[model samples]
Target: MIDALVNGLVILMDPFRMLMLFAGVAIGITVGILPGLGGLMGMALVLPFLFGMDSYAGIAMLIGIAAAVPSADTFPSVLMGIPGSSGSQATIMDGYPLARKGQAARALSASFMASLIGGLIGAVALTALIPFARPLVLAFGSPELFMLTILGLSMVGVLSGSRPILGIIGAVAGLTLGMVGGAPVAPEYRFVFGELYLYDGFSLVILALGLFAIPEIIDLMAKGGSIAQRGPGLGGGWMEGVRDTLRNKWLVVRHSLFGVIIGAIPGMGSSIIDWLNYGYVVQTSKDRSQFGKGDIRGVIAPEAANNSREGGVLMPTLLFGVPGSSAMALFLGALLIFGIQPGPALLRDDLDLVFVIIWSLAIANVMGTVICLALSRPIARLTFVPFYFIAPVVLCIVILGAFQETRHWGDLVALLGFGLVGWLMKRIEMPRPPLLIGFILSGLAERYLWMSYNLYDWDWVYRPLVITIGALCIGLVIGGIWLKRRSAGSAATASDNDGQERLADNRAGEEAQKGAQS
Candidate 1:
């Protein structure tokens, strides 16, 4: 195994392979910076070019693209409140707020640093776990997977913050939208209303762009100022952001591992990994006030998780020929195109190739981070540019992105409809993250629930993993409630103390004035 590892490293070091890797990283970053163009698109564009390329170099280039995307996508999410892709959606919660506070440099740097560390950790974990992961992967049956989806939905409560009812309503709305298309188990559609577009359901790109991007654009244009409302300069330096990530080292490690575990699940895509991590951090923290208002920890958690999950998703794709997520599905196809069979025999015959992938992922992360850091100074300047100047370009890009979903007119209509809904929700101060989370998980939950029933009927509920996950879900709810109440109590006590102190100060001022008059 060590010899194969060394040989793989040696192969990756070849000049042409390194150049291809760099080229892939550049393409990945470019696509990631553009809203709605993710690693999947980049992968599709590069697929045909790999027809007769060296197998090692081709795969290296693909790995480089995958590794760079999660890090690069943070640019749009932080600077403009636009989700560069689904993976960076959670980052916008805190990151964009920080940008508005003139801390764009800080937010961008911290996210890049976390991505670098998380990518390295994921590579190490993948290297260590691949040999022993087969049994663990097989342990999660349909019942257990169903429970996991429920676990993800439970986060809606924590994400909703002070408005639990609104959160629940939003989640229901999202579930309804998710059910609009053809049923997984049944032959009929649920809410199409005879519209052919409804048969395919809403694209995630359109939903996300409409919900978050359009609302922000409208608000910015209406307000008529720069994205950084506070000032013309970045209030904090890049080193400060680096320090923030270092200060939250444990958070980076914890969520990166969480991302790895979630990514290993076949149907659990990148869409919900960051949300789960964000909700978990909020639930566990003692002080929950600064989260959506630009806490650096929020930036660290999701950025770390999104980058690390790339390595985890590869576990199933390589070991079982089961693609863990959509991007991995493309990767699996690429492997087949290269005439390299995945699964057990591939491991036995081509272990060296596996190590090459690990090497490429780790190195690409480093290259991506350094490049982002170098670009942060200039890119961060976007926040200081007036919204009027930036709005037209952003609006055009967003429209283009939404249209690409299906190249159908329905995409634009949905975009406008959801954009209005999102604007209303924002005006009302309703939480939007829960709705996105619910929509992403709804289809998976339905599929898994039916599968469990078909396989074991009522008996599946008694499975140990199912019971364990259910208990964990219950615990999360109770714990979130407890933490929220404690935070409220503390705030009340602090307010009372301040009131008493002000009263005493007023009395002292009166006594002093009376003495002077006398």
Candidate 2:
């Protein structure tokens, strides 16, 4: 393993791979700084370029882009309260609040540091797991995969905010939306309405844009204000944010690890990473009450998880030929075009390609951070842009991007349709992220559950790993319930106290009235 790593390191030392890595990171940061674009789009754009390139250089570009995306995406979330990608949406909940408090630089600093840590963790994991990667990949069968998706569902509780019921409803809605095409086991169509476009299933990109991007556009329009009035601070407050991350090192590590583990399983990606990390931070913090209220840790958790998941996701991709997320799957397809097969044999035959991936990721993270740091001021200035202009442009991007996935007019229709639904859901205080989460996991969970059942005839249910994972899922559900109850009790107690104070004031007023009458 050491020898292979050394050989891989030598391949990464070449100037061409390094340049591609730098370019990829730069492009990823640019994409991430945009309000609607994400690493997925960046990867898609670069996919064609990889068609006939050397395996190492091609993989370098993709790995670099993936590694840097989270670093840049956080800038918008922290500066303008807008998410550059769904992964950074979780950052907006806390990072933007901090920006409103004149701590945009600080928030960016924290976000960058956390992203760096996450990138390192993911890269190391990807590199180290290469030896036994094939077995680890194959060991995850239908039951384990289903359990993993269930774990992702645990994030719904966190997305629900103060309303768990609405969260659940949102989740169910997501599941229904996910089931728009054909059934997993059987070959029958369910909700196509006889449209040819629906036969291939609704595009994940289209749904993502509608569910995540549209809601932000509406909120930005409704608010009629930018996130902050001031431009980025030239002061060294960004360094203070870095200091804050160091202060909470353990939290960053935990969240990054959470992202890696969840991301290692195919079908669970950035959306789950953000919400899962958010939920974990809220549940375990010493001052749990401070979450969602401009807490730096809140920003750090999602930022770390969002970045780290990139690496964790690459594990299954390079090792097992199982793409961890949609972008990675695309990367794998690009590899196949180049006659490069992914898996254990690739490791032995083309260790150089493996090194290129690892080093490219490391180098990309550094380059992305530098680019973000340089552009922080200009990007932060967007907060002063008029809300009206920002609205139409963002809306157009959302619409166009959504339609790009399938090139069908119905997808455009669905985009507008889901936009309205998303807006109404927000009006009623629904947690939209969980609904998306539920939708993403629903297909995977249903498919795996049925496959496991048919294959094992219930014997798989008793497998120790499967049982343990199920128990953990049960515990997460119960834990969510317990937390909700506790929160309700606290709220009730606060209400009772306020009521008693009002009663006392009324009695005092009555006494004064009686004295005046006498």
Candidate 3:
């Protein structure tokens, strides 16, 4: 194992691979700073170009982009008041407020620094976990893996944000979408509707654009403002933000661990980790007043978590062929294209590729952080660009990018159809992440369930691991609801206390004035 890692590190250090990594980081940062396009689009954009590349080189580039995106996305969240991706949404809460107060550079710098540290720590943690990784997959038969899918379903409780029914509906919608093609074990098609395009189902690329990008394009163009609504204080806040990160070093480490832990859970690796970290920090802190009002800790926590999640995401992705997120789903596809299956066989034979993946993530995180820091000064200008101009180009890119995937007219129709649905979803706040998550898990769930029946009959339900995982899934659902309600109650109590204090102060002033007049 050590030898494989050393060889993988050597290959990553090769000049050609290093250059590709640099190129990928550059492209990732560019795409990440854009409001709607995120790392998923960046990876998809480059996917077609990786056909003839070596596995090491291809994975390096993809990891480079994947790791860099979270680091670079802070720019828009802090400066433009727009989340560069779902992962950065919590960032805008305090980061943009800091920018509004002329501290954009501080926010951006701290975010990048936290991202770098968190990513490095996550990579190291994954390295430590790799030796034990095989046992986890080996222990899980079809029953256990199927229970894992149900555990994934439990995450919808946490991700839905006060709308569990909507979350369930969105997940069902994804499962429906996943069912469009032929059944996993049967030859007959279910929802093909006689269209060849429906046979293979919608390409993930088209779904990404329609669900994530098109809605943002429509919103950006409609808003039609400079990306940054306020002047940024980039003049001297870089060092200050660095100092802030240093002061809050433990906070970054704690949240980074949270990111990794949550990420390792089957369906919990989505951007929800970012908000979870932020919320955790806010709830535990002695002084909670500054959380949503330009606090530097806000910038640090989410940045650390989002970046660390990428490394943790690779664990399940490599060991069980289960993707932690939609972006990772694409990664699984890319691996298959390279003739590498991602489960036990790959672990036994292509161990070096896993090491290569680890090295790429670590190096890319460092390189991406450096690149973002260097470009921070110039990219601040992006926040001043008019959305009207940016919108048209992004729309064209999404439409054209969809076509580039399958080179078919049906892709266009799917793009428009899902685009409208996505826009409506945003309006109603239906939580689009569940749709993607469920879609990714649906096929795995079906196959695993079928295999469980064939392998163990109905007795699979009594298996120890299956029962344990199932119980955990139930706990997650109950725990998520309890946590949400408790947090809401705490926040309400605080608000009421503040209101009562203000009322008391007002009455005191009135009584004092009356006494003086008497």
Question: What lDDT, from 0 to 1, does candidate 1 have?
Answer: 0.78
* Backbone Cα, N, C clashes tallied per candidate: 0, 0, 0
lDDT of 1 by residue, 1-518 (tens): 78988998999999999999999898788767755557865665576567789999999998989999999889888877777787887788788779888898899899999999999988998899866854554567778767766765665675566787898788788777888889978998888899999998766657766777778778868977554433334466799999999999999999999888877654354656776777777778999777777888988998999999998888866775545565665576578668886655467688899999999999999999998898766654543556688678768877876776678999899999989998899899897756665665677678889999999988999998889878977886676666545545543443454356558779999999999999
What is the Cα-based lDDT of residue 312 in candidate 3?
84
Index of the highest-lDDT prediction: 3
Instruction: Give a tens-digit lDDT track for model 3, residues 1-518.
Output: 99989988988888888888888888788778877777877886676567778877888898898998898888888877777877887787788778878888888889999999999988988888878877666767788878877766666756677787898899889878888888997787988889988888766667767877778788877877766565644765788888898899999899998888777765553456776777788788999777776789978998999999987888777876766666786687678668786766567787888888999999999999888888777876775677788777767767877787678899899999988998999899897767876776787788889999998889999998888887887886777666556545544543454466558779999999999999
Evaluate all candidate structures by whole-model CA lDDT and list the values in order. Answer: 0.78, 0.72, 0.79
Q: What stretches of model 1 exceed 4 Å from their correct place? A: 134-235, 378-518
Shift of residue 331 alpha carbon in model 3, Å: 3.4
lDDT of 1 at 129: 83
Off by over 4 Å in 2: 1-118, 125-137, 225-227, 236-361, 476-518
Candidate 2: give the clashing pairs. none
My TM-score estimates for the predictions, one after another, are 0.59, 0.62, 0.84
Q: How many clashing pairs does model 2 include?
A: 0
